[model samples]
Target: MKRTRINKYGIVACAILLSLSKVTLAVDNVTPISIPMVANAQVFADFTDDIPAVLNYFTSSTKDEIIDFYNQSFGESIFQEKNESALR
Candidate 1:
């Protein structure tokens, strides 16, 4: 039937377009470094510790506008003012 032919043509055209649309990725010959499992987490903690003061400054600055904030409500502090404070 004419309807069967039209459906076959549509299917063929869709298949051709789908195959042509994909592009193969070409990469350079560079070796990727494998980091330790805890490396990223440790690095993130270090970064968070480094910027505690800046984070506190921003949090304290926005205290009034923000209600029911975890950092202010639960009183759980992150990052110390100094390395000595972190020891205690």
Candidate 2:
């Protein structure tokens, strides 16, 4: 009986911790891409025009953006160097 009570208390404590640990995410506001429209691109045009935006959505760039902000705060030259190195 004591063992069962201890188990019950342990479960209750676990449940409380689990509930507290949950983080509610805000709704994803990014619009979904229309594959059909993208497929309809002109025959001469590149098919990957919209691919960058789609790919960038999955890659969180908050760190890069912050770095860029600090770099730009210094001057355009440093920012340009950073962009050039990224291209390389």
Candidate 3:
């Protein structure tokens, strides 16, 4: 009996994948052109004072209620609006 030949397509696919991986590694080795954190560096430390106890009242409540209230109120402003559906 004659021996079967290996598939050429599978070998070609593997070679292509290997070459792509090398290109990816070469790109990653380059230094980032600029520092990324400049905009985000000052984001923290906005609240210097102690967090108020009132903030805890929010966490104690059920999640759905809190989510509904939050989505309805557009931040703190919505609490003043009289929407019975949102209250439910």
Candidate 4:
């Protein structure tokens, strides 16, 4: 009976190890998204590991120019709001 309990514990440990290895492999296989950046912008911070990456930068370009750059890079139509925000 003691041998049987030891065998069961060993099997359970192996199963846990195998599941953890699979999870590690899945995380390693994740492909990172390519982020488009504005030209000549000074980057403050970048959080690429997040689900949707965050980029903070400062640019001397006008708001319209920045909007045009993003629209061209993303290949999507974007509109500027009266509050000085751009949305796709």
Candidate 5:
């Protein structure tokens, strides 16, 4: 009986360690991406934990002004009408 209890405890400990390791690996695998924001923009919502993170905000800046800011930030003219003028 004592040996059986010891085996059960060992199995439980191994399971716990395996689960913890999986969580650690998952956290490590999530490479954080930096997103540029418009200056003086009012952020209404931000959901960074989701796959393809989302950010919602409003700015008084004109559409062209916003596009220019992102273009300069990313060092490319990435904002276009085809992508709804959004950075992918």
Candidate 6:
């Protein structure tokens, strides 16, 4: 009974910590802008493709090149992290 109680408390504590971390990370990284946002205002028509060829034009090396390009283009202060994940 005591062990089960401890496990429940431990899980709750972990969940709380994880949520707090996410909140802090988001808040710390936010930049203030003067613009109030509008919802889904599109200047261009939507794509008509059944299966969109997103990123297919980009070669494998384009991923790394994109990161480098953005870092150079934006001068690194606005962009802090680059993370890439792929599933087989």
lDDT to native, each model = 0.40, 0.45, 0.53, 0.80, 0.79, 0.51
What is the overall TM-score of model 2 with all chains considered together? 0.21
Off by over 4 Å in 2: 1-4, 24-81
Model 6 Cα lDDT, one tens digit per residue, 1-76: 3554367888899999999999989777755433211232332433323234211222344445655754676557
Candidate 2 residue lDDT tens string, 1-88: 3554367888899998777666322223334444222222333333343334322222234646645654666544432334567566
Instruction: Write the residue-wise lDDT of candidate 5 on 1-88 in tens digits.
Output: 3554367888899999999999998887886555779878898988775468888898899878987898888877634456655655
Model 3, span 1-88: residue lDDT tens: 9998999999999999999999989867764332122221333323223233112121344645656666665545434545789667
Clash count (model 3, backbone only) = 0
31, model 3: CA deviation in Å? 0.6
Which one wins on TM-score? 4
Candidate 6 colliding pairs, count: 0
Estimate, for each residue in 1-88, the C-alpha lDDT of model 4 and write its tens digit: 3554368888999999999999999889777666787778998987766568888888898877887898888776756447535433
Task: Estimate TM-scores for all models.
Answer: 0.20, 0.21, 0.35, 0.66, 0.56, 0.30
lDDT-better candidate, 3 vs 6: 3
Better of 1 and 5 by lDDT: 5
- The C-alpha stretches of model 6 lying farther than 4 A from their native spots are 1-6, 33-88
What is the Cα-based lDDT of residue 5 in candidate 3? Answer: 95
> Distance from true position, residue 13, model 4, in Å?
4.2
Cα lDDT of candidate 3 equals 0.53
